[model samples]
Target: MSLDMSLEIEGEIPDWEALDNAIRSVGVINYEIDRDYVFQGAFKKSDGYFWLSKRSEAQRKTVIAEGNHGCSFCVYNAIVFRINNFYYDDFVEDMNSFLKKLTSLSSMQFVLSFQYEDVYAVRNKRGFEFFWDQPR
Candidate 1:
């Protein structure tokens, strides 16, 4: 079983340095790239980079994605990141901090969607907040 979190932010993507720093707040990244590491000073969208978290033993990857992506919900014109398969026990807190750090980099609002096991949740700055929703 894996945990996945997606962050959707409006407008242009933040610079790679800022994104790197914010991601490091949760764990140390392995940073695997082959000439695709940076793009116009921002993270190259849809690329997945592997990482290791200090809080968990599991190894995982985080992907910089583009456009709107939610299973049931929708967020448009956003720069997205999909942090995948992190089994940290205190992940919810870490995600909250991650979102806060990202929000600080720019004035754009953020939308976050997370899933673990049977639970799925969405948290956003511009309203549309919801707790766990288990599928029927």
Candidate 2:
């Protein structure tokens, strides 16, 4: 089974010439970043199931982009990305913290997962963070 994680943020994404810039900025060494920003050797490198944005071109345009920017992925959001099924917490946390530091505007998050369930980390107008579950 493959596990997926996505970082969803709005506003002020840090400029990175390559995905390596972001990966290195987070201080995770030993993982190779490719030109596509796809997972190369982090986890499950031998398995084809562990692929991010596995959707076809037409499918990705419809499903992932949601008509926003015409199937192009924004750095602020990573949808359906592949990672180790059991060992993705560090990745998620690091991504969250990395994004939070890019701007002073604060942020919120909505994550839907089949294994971990749906989680929303919301940053309110008061500049505080809160968590809630969806589909209640």
Candidate 3:
């Protein structure tokens, strides 16, 4: 299952490399094309992108997305914030601001992501915006 924030920026992401580098301290930006080569007889995956934070505890954070060369829907290409944990907050926060900073240049929209944790029959809502400082 793929998931992330509901907000995102589309079109040419300015200074994409620099932006990727800036967030390295939190997580890594992985373009699908860079890895996962197709077998000689297999078909190559289309252009898509996404990233994940190294696992620290029992869980890991990720954003399965697409860029200009990809279709709009795949994973939660529209990253919102947080999964079911708070430790992943910083990365979410940083990306939030990063996208916010680019709002003027790219076409992006932040939408509400409904999340819930199930404890048997009860569902606990743990919704909040998570973030980190963007490297200067």
Candidate 4:
């Protein structure tokens, strides 16, 4: 199955270099980063998952509000991680593990979304825009 993973980070990481290092440490194939989000390209692994790590208070608030109230900020962040196919249970487990590791090292609160493929910004009737793709 094809798996697309998106990781969100708020604030600056003192060890920003570790971001790529951590992902590499996971041994996944086709990993790519664009701005603040990291996308692990489609993988054939049994299971897959993505982590949204919030390093700042603003980022944490965004996650909580989006999760609890469908906040626009959350909707925008959701656009980056889109997959074209369904995943198996193993994918979910692996994703959770990845998230756990990121949070443990970064001290950032994270939210986990499993087997989600629909891109929110494009699909939403409201035409929400993703943070990364916004015109400068």
Candidate topping TM-score: 4
Candidate 3 runs further than 4 Å off: 1-4, 8-27, 33-86, 110-112, 115-136
Estimate, for each residue in 2-56, the C-alpha lDDT of model 2 and write its tens digit. Answer: 5554433232232323344444455553455455545433422222122233343
**lDDT values for all models:** 0.38, 0.36, 0.29, 0.39
Error of 3 at 37 (Å): 16
lDDT (Cα) of model 3: 0.29
How far is 109's C-alpha from truth in model 4 (Å)?
3.1
Superposing every Cα of model 2 onto the true structure, what RMSD results?
A: 7.8
Q: Give the C-alpha lDDT of model 2.
A: 0.36
Off by over 4 Å in 1: 32-86, 115-136
Residue ranges of candidate 4 with Cα displaced over 4 Å: 1-8, 12-16, 34-40, 47-61, 68-80, 83-86, 114-136
User: How does residue 60 of candidate 3 score in lDDT?
Assistant: 23
Per-residue C-alpha lDDT of model 1 across residues 25-118, encoded as one tens digit per residue: 5554444322344321212222233231121223122222332323333223232234333434344445555555655564444444442222
TM-score between candidate 2 and the true structure? 0.40
Clashing pairs in 2: none
Q: Model 4 — which ten-residue stretch has the worst lDDT?
A: 119-128
Q: How many backbone clashes can be found in candidate 4?
A: 4
User: What TM-scores do the predictions have?
Assistant: 0.42, 0.40, 0.29, 0.44
Candidate closer to the true structure by TM-score (higher is better), 3 or 4: 4
**Deviation in angstroms for 122 in model 1?**
7.4
- Please state the error at residue 2 of candidate 4 in Å: 10
